[model samples]
Target: MPAKIVVIANQKGGCGKTTIAMQVGGTLGRAGNRVLIVDADPQGTATRWAASAADESSFPAHVAGLAAAGGKVHREIKKYLDSYDYILVDCPPAVDSPVPQSALLIADVALVPIIPSPADLWAATGTRGLIERAGDINTALQARMVVNMLQSNTSMSKEVLEVLEDFGIPLTLAKLHLRTAYRQAAVFGGTVHDLGREAAKAVQEVEALAHEILSLFKNN
Candidate 1:
């Protein structure tokens, strides 16, 4: 079976794209799925996170240079698609960047992680456009966005939640709470699943994401 490809992307910075990628991949890996992470960004954030021993048996991820691939990254990803149960790509901040666009080219699902706010919502418009453009190449691409770092009490968060509900994107029903555990765990090279109490909320959120992604691959 071909592995489901998930590209976590956002053109704007600070939207937690890499964070969501690592967390989602980590969750899937720890759940006994064969997982491969492709660090498409020049920064190699996911590659470093996997290489660090502090994260789950020190998994070393594949790092492919977009410039070197010259539109061949999709073929490369397809070659590895059957080797794992999941192939999650951690894309750069620039949605138009070749690496990210290539990620979309090969992706089965595009998970766009964004903060809950009007500004972030506005940024998603550009992301949607980029994904649509990439869709012209990869017709199998499916896109979904999740709200992250949400503060329950904030008016912005509430307003954004309603707005997104009205906007009708496949929004994750479970949200990631703003917590120090996520930050602390990442610094140690692990994910929310490692934290005991501080991770209670995140665990559910990631689990929900996994369930949602899993639904995409289900066949009648």
Candidate 2:
């Protein structure tokens, strides 16, 4: 079977799009599945994260930069469809960028990461529209909103969660908390699993997310 394509995109910057793409892709790779991360963002953050890994223990998944492919990204990604179990495209935050649309065209699922804030929620409207439009072209495309950097204790976070419950996009049950371990993982060029005991909670969060996402494919 061809690889499952997951496109991580959000209209707002600082929503942790790269982090989710890397962590989930890494977790799947670590589980012995062949995984590839298509760095579709011009910023190349995903490429840099993999490059930061040490020679002895490089990032589990292959990182490929396809930012230059722009609107033709889906066509480019087609070349690797049979070579991996999963291909995750990390899209740039720019609302005007064609990368997200191109990616969604071929994606089995689209993961839209949103920070728990009024601004983030407002910005997500544009993404919701984009996904809805993409669905018309790619009828098989599914989309879920993954809440990131959530602070459960905060009243603002609570309010945002409440609001998102009615947000057009369905929310993922697994959420990422505001944790230092996530940042550490990027610096070390690996997933939360690489941080050892310090990232136990983060590890659980990411693993749960991976499991949930995989279940989507299984159910289909």
Candidate 3:
């Protein structure tokens, strides 16, 4: 079967797109799936994250850079569809970028990560529109909004959550909280699961996200 392609995109930067792509891809890989992370962002943050891993215990998933492919990314990714069980594309953070639209053309799902802030919410409108447009052509393409760096206690977060209910794209049940372990994982070039006991909560969050994402393809 062809791999389930998940394009992680948001027009605004600093929304944790790479973090979500890597963490979710890594968790799925550890769960015995052949996962591949296509780093479509010119920033190459995903490539660097895998490169930073230690030789003894490298990142669970394979990371490939396809930023140069630009609008041809969907064509490029098609070549690997049969080789892996999952392909997660981390798109560049730009509203004008062709990468997100290209990837979404062949994607099984598009996950838009948004920070729980007024600015982030406002910026996400562009992405929501992009997804909506893509869905018109790619009828099988599903979309979900993932709340990242969520500070549940803050009034801003609460308001953002309420607003997201009508944001067009459905929200994911699993949310990632503001935690130091996520940063540590990036530094160490691994998922939160590698952080051991101190990152228990973080591990659960990523795992839950992976589970929810995988469930979307269960009937396929």
lDDT per model vs. reference: 0.75, 0.94, 0.94
Q: Which stretches of candidate 3 lie above 4 Å from their native place?
A: none
Best by lDDT: 2
* Pairs clashing within candidate 2: none
> Tens-digit lDDT track for model 2 on 36-138?
9999999999999999987625789999999999999999999999999999999999989999999999999999999999999999999999999999999
What TM-score does model 1 achieve against the real structure?
0.88
- C-alpha root-mean-square deviation, candidate 2: 0.9
List, in order, the clash count of every candidate structure: 0, 0, 0
Error of 2 at 215 (Å): 0.6
Candidate numbers sorted by TM-score from highest down: 2, 3, 1
Candidate 3, after superposition: displacement of residue 73 in Å? 0.4
Q: Give a tens-digit lDDT track for model 1, residues 1-220.
A: 8888888888888788777877777777888888877766777666666565464575423333343453456777787877898988777786557767776877888888879988999988888887888888888777788888899898879888888886645787767778787676667677777778768877888788777788887731
Tens digit of lDDT per residue, candidate 3, span 1-220? 8899999999999889999999999999998999999999999999999999986347889998999999999999999999999999999997889999999999999999999888989999999889999999999998999999999999989998999999899999999999999999999999999999999999999999999998988746
TM-score, every prediction: 0.88, 0.98, 0.98
Q: Arrange candidates by lDDT, descending.
A: 2, 3, 1
